[model samples]
Target: MKGALREALQRARVDKVPVALVTQLEGGAQNLVYSSDQSNAEISLGSSQLEEIRDMLRVARSGMLPGDEFFVRSYVPPYRLLIVGAVHIAQALSVMAAQCDYQVTVIDPRRAFATAERFQGVELCAEWPDEAMARLLPDAQTAVVTLAHDPKIDDPALIAALGSGAFYIGALGSRRTHGKRLERLTDLGLEDQLQRINAPIGLKLGGRGHAEIAVSILAQLIQARYGG
Candidate 1:
């Protein structure tokens, strides 16, 4: 039974289909197996890289077999996120963004701030702004945030985001700062792209602390993405 189940799983993996190997023992029967076709997968599961429903189905069907292991291999998507900063605000924002179905990635040229210690669960990239951005081939679903205040970094990423159809494009800066940044961006032939930016990013909750500000920013981002 175990061997048969593994074969089905292998076939499903190769075809890029999701399945659950539900097992059962009926009276004297050792094992009975069922499968949930990938097309019929019911739950969205909030981007958790696993087919937990399948695992649950398997356990329910095949009660407790000492050597039986029913688990779902992690399911990964092609989506990604790119954040440009290693500041306090960036740290907080990354945490929340990660929870919201994003494959979070943070980039910064400052080695001191961009460390495994600061970005606990993020994929940190400490390379020059333009050089780092060149590595990302964002699609329409990608989200790009320019949390770095430095023009050298923020400006480059902003330009790139404007060019791409990234679902969300936000920048961290004050009204004055954004105004000046806008002028500079216009100078770079992005005059018509001004409408694409969510400058002075985040809703007006009127808070200044690092964490609170991060909350406001991510809140707005969620609304935009989920149609809330």
Candidate 2:
């Protein structure tokens, strides 16, 4: 029985999705504790557990709720941010996004700029725009940013982003530049998506340069992602 329990836990951890491990511990107030994180799921003979613990865990495996923490922690997934450019704005936004609980990732084919020396502590990927984006397509909790104004970099990145479930899709640009860019996107059969993007990106802050502009950009992005 112990060996089977261990095998089942190993498989659950290998699957990498959250699971509630319910177990009864011997004669203690905390006997009914259930573990949501696999790291804390361990059972030792002398360590003490109720005999019926395995059955409780079996019920949980069938998708039964075990406890409050099990429902709250295991069910909530991490928020993800995929920045499609390792530019200066990305440099600033990455830090801000991390502070706001986003798992930030940066993708740019330029090895020089994408290196750890520049992006330090961020998921920097030196891959082609669309291909790099394919691996990080947005979900309900995802937000995307295209900091590079260059079409070779920004266009394809935005194309892949707009086609996904990303809650927020922003491209840095001025209103006039947005007009010209829109014409090009429409010519390329991306007008519908062009409308979907938060272009002339950022709120009406009337700011310039990298950092402050990034602040405005992030403000607008978060608002679009979470606001009504």
Candidate 3:
């Protein structure tokens, strides 16, 4: 890595901008491609290949050809898992998310259950969901989940997360429960954004335990991340 490329990568990381590096095989000429719509990039890579590079950056993957002159390396933002609950499922999900190399934050207004003793080795925000999410600011690399059965807390957080660039938004509820939630959101003028949410919040794993449910949710999150 040259000094310029290293500095550009550092800037992109600090600014939370998704960028891709294309390096020429012969002269080692390098170019940085940002994923922001406002950036009208004028690089040697064709418009079609640049679009593909953007998708590769979204999934945090590198693209290389077998006998091509250039290779693309993605510099995406870090993966974040924001859980708007402090329940048993959140405890299990937090641990699993950490294992999968996600920066996990658990937010809940109930300080009693959101204590450090319960959620060990994870970031805890005892503030209300809206306040905590305001500070957290879910981005394109983030996955937001609401495991708090209380709609008062989960709904507000969902509204905030849905408005942000978080790649995944999920809620833990049955179909009937989700329907009620949807009605509430619709009444709040969030009907247009409802399709972005993944309710019932997990793969059909046919198990009801906290750990099992955590596994299913994490599986769905992986599918969201990798587009599987």
Candidate 4:
């Protein structure tokens, strides 16, 4: 790799940007393709090829093109899970998410709940949800879940997630609770984005335990991630 390309790849990795390196099989020509930006290419590609590269980037797949003339290798950022509450459910969810290759971060203002002993090996943020969300800047590779069950914490986090490109946003609440939550968000002028939130979060797997709920949430999250 040349110095410029190597530097760009390093920068992309640090910024958690999804990028692809397209190499011509014959001449070894190369191009760097970004998910949402212009490409840095020494070789030209048609619109269809660019679209195909984007599809591969979305799924983080690397493969040869139709004609076998070029190969695209994708470098996708690690999937991130930002939990807005450090509750019992979060403990199970964090462990499950980590096992499933998600970089999990649990955020809570309550020091007692966001303790390291409770959530071993998980990133804990003792800041308010909104503050933490602002700093995190959730993106397309990120999933945000609000399990706090408190409007003061969950609402702000939901608002932040709704405004971001986070692939999934879920809130733990009943139908009635979600209705009230919607009213509050609507009053805050987020009616249009409310559909993005999966309230009463998790699949209805007929389980009520914390671990079961975590399983359902993780299942739903995987489904959303792959467009299933």
Q: Report lDDT (CA) for all predictions.
A: 0.71, 0.68, 0.88, 0.93
Better of 3 and 4 by TM-score: 4
Higher-scoring candidate on lDDT, 1 or 3: 3
Give candidate 2 misplaced runs (Cα > 4 Å).
1-75
> Highest TM-score: which candidate?
4
TM-score of 3: 0.80
Task: Kindly give the stretch of ten consecutive residues in candidate 1 with the minimal lDDT sum.
Answer: 25-34
Question: How many clashing pairs in candidate 4?
Answer: 0
Which lDDT tens digits does candidate 4 get at residues 43-84? 899989999999999899999989999999999888999999
Residue lDDT tens for model 2, 125-151:
888889888876677678888877778
Give a tens-digit lDDT track for model 1, residues 127-203.
87677777875656688888889998899888888888888888999999999999999999999988778878988
List where candidate 4 sits over 4 angstroms from the true fold: 1-15, 23-51
- Per-model TM-score, in order, reads 0.68, 0.68, 0.80, 0.82
Better of 1 and 2 by lDDT: 1
lDDT (tens digit, per residue) of candidate 3 on 172-196: 9999999999999999999899999
Q: Highest lDDT: give the candidate number.
A: 4
Task: Report clash pairs, candidate 4.
Answer: none
